[model samples]
Target: MTSNDAWWRGAVIYHVYPRSFQDTSGDGIGDLNGITQRLGHIAELGADAVWISPFVRSPMRDFGYDVLDYCDVDPMFGTLEDFHRLLDTAHKRDLKVLMDQVLSHTSSDHPWFLESRASRDNAKADWYVWADPRPDGSPPNNWLSVFGGSAWQWEPRRSQYYLHNFLREQPDLNFHNPSVRAAVLDVCRFWLEMGVDGFRLDVCAFYFHDPELKDNPPNPNRPSGKSFMFNPYSMQRHVNDIGQPENLAFLEELRGLCDAYSAVLLGELHETDAEKLHREYTAPGRLHLAYGYWLLGAEEIGAGDLYGLVRALGHEAHEGWPAWALENHDFMRAPSRLADGEAPMALTAALISMRGAFCFYQGAELGLPEANVPFERLADPYGREFYPAYPGRDGSRTPIPWNADAPHSGFSEVEPWLPIPAEHRALNAEDQGRLAGSVLARMRRFLNWRRTRPELRDGNMDMLDLPEPVFGFVRAREEDRLLCLFNLGDGPVDVDPPQTGFGTPVEGHGLDWASHAGRVRLPRGGGYFGELA
Candidate 1:
C-alpha cells in the first residue's frame, strides 16, 4: 500500500491554514506565495503531505469556507498562478499538496445560488435546498445550526426558505440534484487538472441531506466529560439532518474521479457517531482518510481519554484509516488544552504513532497554545455567536510566528488579519530552530526519525493497557515490532514493559527517557520509542 498511488495511507499531513501560515504579500494575510516560501519548513519537518485549509474565493464570512467561486483563488490568497507555483515547489521537495474542497455549501453570492433564487422557474432553481415555510411560517423542520439557531434562512425572492447548516450567507447545495453533483465534480476536476495531489473535503458529511427534510431528535445525553460545556448543537442527535446513506454513492462518484488522477479524498466527519460513520465511508471505494471531533473538541485530553480513543478506533487492519488531529484551525491548541499546559511532545509522539495518517496543525511544533483573542478580535462566526461560552476558534488560528523579534513575528509586515499572541513570540521558528530541546527541534527530529521506521509507517497496531500516566501502543510489521509510549502526566512515571524480555531503546527519537531497575522511566512530557523482541 506504499505505492505512489497510495502514499496517503500512512502519510503525515501537515495542515496549513493559508490565512495564517505566512505573508509574503505584506498585506497582513498569508497567500499562496507565502506558503511557497514556507514549503521548506514542512519538507524539513518530514511531513509526507500538506493539507491546506480552503483559500478559494469567498466573502470571509467563515474565513474561506464560504466559497463564492470554487474554481478561482480568493485575491486575498493570491491568483491561480500563485497556487501552481506553491504546488510545484512542494512537489520539488517531495511533499504532496491537498487542497480543501468545500462542496457542501457556497456563499449566498455564488452565481448558481443567484440564478437559482431569482425566479423559481430558472434552470438552476433546484440547485440549492429550498423549502416552503409551514402554515405558521416557521422553518420547514426543526433543525439547528452548529453555529447557533435555526438551520433555515428565509429568502424573499423565491418565497421560500433555503437550508443553511452554517451561516445564512452560506447556503447548502442540493446534492440530490444531479446537476449540482456534476458541477461539484467539475470543481474537483479543475483543481486536479491544476496538479494538486488530493483534496481534504470540508464538512464532507454535510454534502447530502435527508430528502424528506425530517426533524432531528433531541439527544438523550447532553455534553459531558469536558471543560467545554453545552450548546444547542450538543442537544440534538442529528439523525436525519446529516449522515444520510445517499452520501456514499456521491463519494463513490468522487472516488472514481480521484482514482483517475491517483488523488486522495480525506473527508471531515461530524462527531455524530463519527467513528461509526468513518468505518462505513472508508469501507472500499470511499474517502482515503477521515477525521472528526475525536479528541479535538475537548478543552483537555487525559490519559484515560487517549485510551478510550484507541478502544473506539482500534489498530486492527480491518478498521478504516483515520487522520488524527489533536489540534487544528478549529479549536484550542494541544499544549494549552490537551493537558495542564504541558505534554506537547508526548501528545505529538502519540499522534504520529497512531495506525493511520494524521494532520499536524501549524504552530504545533512551536508549542503554541491558544492565544487569548478577546471578543473584540474574534472573527469566527461560531465564536461570535457563542462568545464568552465558546471563546471562538480565533485563538488557535493566530498567525504562525517565524521570527521572535521580527515585526508581526515575520508573518506579515503589518499586523495580521488576527492578532499574534505574545506567548508564541518566544517560541518562534528562528528561536526554537536554534534551540537543542525546543518543541520545534524535538518535533522535527522525531518526525525525521519516524520516516525511517517501517513499523511506525505501516504496521498492525495493538493498544497497550499500561499503568496510569503511561498510555500508548505497539506497531508490528514482520521483523519490526516497535513500542511507542508517552508520559501523559506530570512528575515521573515508571512502568514495566508490557512484555519485558528483549526491550531495547531506539536512539535519536528525541525523548529524554531513562531506565531504572527494569522499568522504563519517563519524566513530564517524556516519550519513548523502542523495539521489542
Candidate 2:
C-alpha cells in the first residue's frame, strides 16, 4: 500500500460496536466472526473504513474499554486468528480497519496493575499512579468519576489510593514514567505491525493526570451545561485530574510510533474545550484526526446549527483535521434525538456530505430510532442508576435488524444480548434493502454518489446564505465545484435557481431541479443534492 494514500482523509467510517454488531454463534453476543460476516453490508454502503470499538482482552467492567491484554483479542469477541481473518476479509473488500485503543487507563486485573499493586518496591510498582491518602483519610482530591462518584479508589493491600477517572476497576496508568510509555508504545506497534490501518484513541484527553495530586477547584458555572447535569464529574474544572499540558509530548510520541507503520490515529476528545484541544492534539505531527462530541450532543440539529458548526471549524480548524459524527456508542440516536422524532434521512445525508470526514454508528444508516428499554429490562449500569432521569447508552446499542420476520429479528437463533425494539421489525435490513426510498437505500445511493465527487473527497467548504432551514454549501477544488443544498425543516420550500457550470441535471437520484427557476420543491423531511452544470 502506498503510505501517502491517506484514504481516510475524507472517508466515511462505519462504527461497529462488536458486542452488538452480529453474533455468528448462538451466544447471543456479537464477535469478530459476526463482524466478518457483516463486512459485505458495510462495504456496500460505500464506506472507506470501519472503526470497531475496543475488543481487547478485558474483564468487561467497562465493556472492553478497560483493557487487560493489549495485544490479544478478547475471548468474548474472538481469538487472534479470528481477528486476522477479519482483517483479511475486510482488506479483500477494500475497507480499512481502525480499532479502538484505550490507553488512558487499564483494568485492575491487568498484569501491569497486579504487579504494581503487589508492593511499593516491585519492578512495576510505579507503573500506575499510587498516592497516600490525605491526613483526613478522604479522597486525595475532589475529582469525580464520569459514572458518578469519587475518581480515586483505595487499594487496601498497597495502603494507598490509585486514580481512576472512570470506574474503580480502571486504574489510571502513570504515563509520566518513561518505562510505561515505552511499554504502551510497544503495544501500539504490535498492532500496527499486524496490518491494521489506524486506531481510534479512546478518551484521548485523559491520558495523563496531575503529578502533584492537587484538588481541582470547583467550576463556578458548572450547573448550566450537559456535562454537569449528566454526571457530577463535570462540577469541577478538572485541571488536576486530566487534560494536562504534558499530554502533548505523549501525543507526539504516539504519532512517531504510528509514523513507523504508516497508521493513522484519530483521538476521541472529551472535554469542554475540545475544539481547542483538538487543534493542539492534531497540529502537525500529533493526532491525525480529533473528534469532539459537540454535534453528537446537540438536542436538536438544523440547517443553521449545521452551517454554524462547519463555519466555526472552517475558520478555526487550523492544522487539525475534523472528524464529525451524529451518533455513536455513547449517545442517543439522531433520528429520535431530533425534535420531531421524524426520520431525518435527508438531513443526515446533508450533514455527512459536509467538509469533514465522518463516522456513522451501525444502525444510523437505517434511520433506526432509539430503542426504549424498559427500566426492568435495562442492561446499562449507568441507565439503571439514573433511571427515568437519564437512560443509559444501551438504548442506542440494540442489535442490528437484519430480517424483519425472523425470530429475534434474524440477529441470532437465541435471544440477543439486547432486546431488538419491536418497532424496528418493519425497518429491518431485509425490508429496507428492497425499498429504494428507504433510509438504508438512500444512504447507499448517497455514499455511491459521494465517492465519485473529487471535490467532496478533499475540498474546502463555503456556506451560502440560503433561507432558514436550508443549508447551502459549496464544496470546491481547483478543477471542480459542487453545490449541496439541504432543507432541514418541515413543509416545502422553494429557492431561486443557482448559478452553476454544468447544465444537465443528474437524474434518477431522488432529485428534481429545473436549471431555469432554481425553485426546487422539497418535501417535508426530504433532501437531495443536484450537480451544478
> Which model scores highest in TM-score?
1
Candidate 1, residues 1-533, lDDT tens digits: the string is 36688778789999999999999888998999999999999999889999999998998999988899998999999999898899899999999999999999999999999999897999999999999999999999999887788999998998899999989999999999999999999999999999999999988889888999988898886656342364677789888888899999999999999999999999898888887888888878999899888778775666788788767765588777888887889877777775476545776688788788979899888888789998888888888888787778898899999997789999999989899978788789998988888888889999998888887777888887777788778888888888888887777888786763326889998887898897888888788878888
All candidates: CA RMSD (Å):
1.6, 2.5
- How many steric clashes between backbone atoms does each model show? 0, 4
Query: Could you tell me the C-alpha RMSD of candidate 2 in Å?
Result: 2.5
Q: What is the TM-score of each candidate against the true structure?
A: 0.97, 0.94
**On residues 1-533, what C-alpha lDDT tens digit does candidate 2 reach at each position?**
11246676678889999988888878998999999999999999889899999998998877898899999999988899999999999999999999899988999999999999988999999999888888988888787888878888888889999988778889989999999899989889999989999899998898788888888888776633332376776678777777889999999989988888878898888755676786688788898877888777766777778776665555232446778888999888887776767646657667667766788899988888889988877777777767677888898999998987778888887988889988887789988999988888878988887787777767766667777777777777675667777777777677565554332345544533333354666666555465553
**Which structure among the candidates has the greatest lDDT?**
1
Instruction: Please list all clashing residue pairs in model 1, or write none if there are none.
Output: none
